[model samples]
Target: EKMPLTPNGKLDRKALPAPEGALQTGTEYAAPCTVTEAKLVQLWQEVLGLERVGIHDNFFEIGGHSLRAMTLVSRVNKEMSVSLPLRNVFFYPTVEEMAQAISELERLEYAVIPQAEARDYYPVSS
Candidate 1:
């Protein structure tokens, strides 16, 4: 049975308190194996300075803001070649969801995108 209850008879997640101390490093999540999970965890650490971050932890719950969220997406693109839009993070905040998105993105970009259209173009310097 659920341990907590909200005002409206829902899960009182906000009312629930955090652990007494900082989260422990190497905490495990039921996340799948994928580059996206690794990358997302790394970004979380760089932003939060945590030795390790679990997959199920919420970014904002851990003190992330919109500015930091944007930074995260930008870093994901630059580092993982995955152009994760800002909204995507909100929708898929968990590592498992993000990994699914990353796999789908890889399939679309690599398997379906036409080579000609995907080629990087540079305008002539005048």
Candidate 2:
């Protein structure tokens, strides 16, 4: 359906109705399950100034922007000690996806780290 326009021939944004299936009404809210998810949710809440955040909630949909996204990435890196690409948050944009990416990165880092080994050194008499 076409959107309604004002007298000046501009689209009336305020008159626009919420998108179908986008609004969650009377639905039971689910909290973050894992530690990563929980930390992400907390960071999101602090950055977005929202009271509650769900794992599936879109970051941009909840008032997140590019600057906020950077802040989120920095916080995640500091808190989780994982280097997450900025684009990853844009691509994922959800706690669940970001957490999964972090987990994967952690796993990859673990695999790449070499195990500790003892090295024998001999001294030569001069």
Off by over 4 Å in 2: 1-28, 107-126
Model 1: runs farther than 4 Å from truth?
Answer: 1-20, 23-32, 107-126
- Candidate 1 lDDT over 1-126, as tens digits, reads 456997688888876776687654344554435666887788777976766567777776666788888888777776777667799889887666776777777522322344555548856796
Taking all chains together, each candidate's TM-score versus the true structure is 0.58, 0.63
Number of clashes recorded per candidate: 0, 0
Candidate 2 minimal-lDDT segment of 10 residues: 107-116
Q: Distance from true position, residue 1, model 1, in Å? A: 34
List model 2 lDDT by residue over 1-126, tens digit each. 898999999999999996665345333456899998999999999998888889888888778899999999877877777888899989898899889888988522212457657669656799
lDDT scores in order: 0.71, 0.83
RMSD over all Cα atoms, model 1: 11.8
